[model samples]
Target: MTYQESHFFIWIAAAYLLGSVPTGLLLGKLYGIDVRRQGSGNIGATNLYRTVGRKVGVMTLVGDCLKGIAPVLLARQFGLSGEQIAWIGLAAFCGHVFSIFLKFKGGKGVATALGVFLALSPLAVLVALILFVLLMLKWRYVSLGSVCAAAVMPLAVALLSGGRTLTLVTFLIGLIVIVRHLENIRRLLAGTENKFKA
Candidate 1:
């Protein structure tokens, strides 16, 4: 295959690998505690923060976010089409949600999803951030706010893009985000979910 043709597979694989880095696991290992075995028994930034401390949690969040951003940005450097970019975003999201290194079990993909959308559509990201803050502050529930923010992403992209490929991609990403939070939703419904502290 030509170099241009080969970029399709190369980009997807690279993005997936980037997404599968497992920032939470690395942070937990750094602290000598398996974060998955601790609070929430999940390998996400929130659990990492609850298990370790603010510093480690912050680092994990940054790493996870960067993973999504980096791959898509790199793909853009190759002058890919909008559809290709959307595919890159999807692959990256899947990698984060089902990382290969983590036995195909990974985080809820909120932060990583945000990273992809943030880089691909900054305006949508800004709107989602605003919604996230409003919901979180009004309800004092991070998961609720996060889910609402994710749900708004596709709408925001639609408003910004006029139903382009990015719109559909954002919608799919938003749905994936919600699906990843199913456990949190169950906990929230049962009133057993813990809220984040200031």
Candidate 2:
């Protein structure tokens, strides 16, 4: 293919690599515990909080968010268009959801999804953040907050981002987050889901 095609492939590869960093796993290993084997058996921030402590959980949260933001920023630096940038953002989200090193078992993709949305549509992020805070305040449940945030993400993006490609990308991202949280929803309905502790 042409040079542009090759460059696009390279950028996507880079984005995937960024997404595959496994921040939770790395932090868990540092603390001498396999995060996947502990607590809820999830390598996400919630599990980190239950298995380890708030410090490590916050670290995982920041790292996961950065993985999403970094690659999209790099793609922009490469001078990719809005449409072309969507691919890289999607790759980053996919990497977080299906990390190669995690045996394909990954987090709920909420944090990573936020990273991409933050890069592509800042206003959408602000709107989702407000909704997330309000929902979590009322329910005191992270999973419910995450589910509501994901559900609102698409509408937020559609309203904040007028382009079809960006809107579609945001919709898919939100869908993925919601689908990943299916178990959480079930637990919420059953009143068995764990809540965030101070």
- Shift in Å, residue 129, candidate 2: 0.7
lDDT of each model, Cα atoms only?
Answer: 0.86, 0.87
With a 3 Å backbone cut-off (N, CA, C), the pairs that clash in candidate 2 are none
Clashes of each: 0, 0
Model 2 reaches what TM-score against the true structure?
Answer: 0.97
Candidate number of the best TM-score: 2
What are the runs in model 2 whose C-alpha is more than 4 Å off? none
- Per-residue error for 170 in candidate 1, Å, reads 1.3
Q: Work out the TM-score per prediction.
A: 0.94, 0.97
Per-residue lDDT of candidate 2, residues 1-198 (tens digit): 999999889888888878887899899999899988898788888899888999999889989998888888888887898887987898888888889877776888888888898999999899999989998888789988888888888888888787888888888888889899888899999999887777
Candidate 1 lDDT by residue in tens digits, 1-198 = 999779698998888888988889988998899988999887788888888988888888898899889888887887888788888988888898899998898888888998898789899899999989988888778789889988998888888855578888788878888888898899999999898985
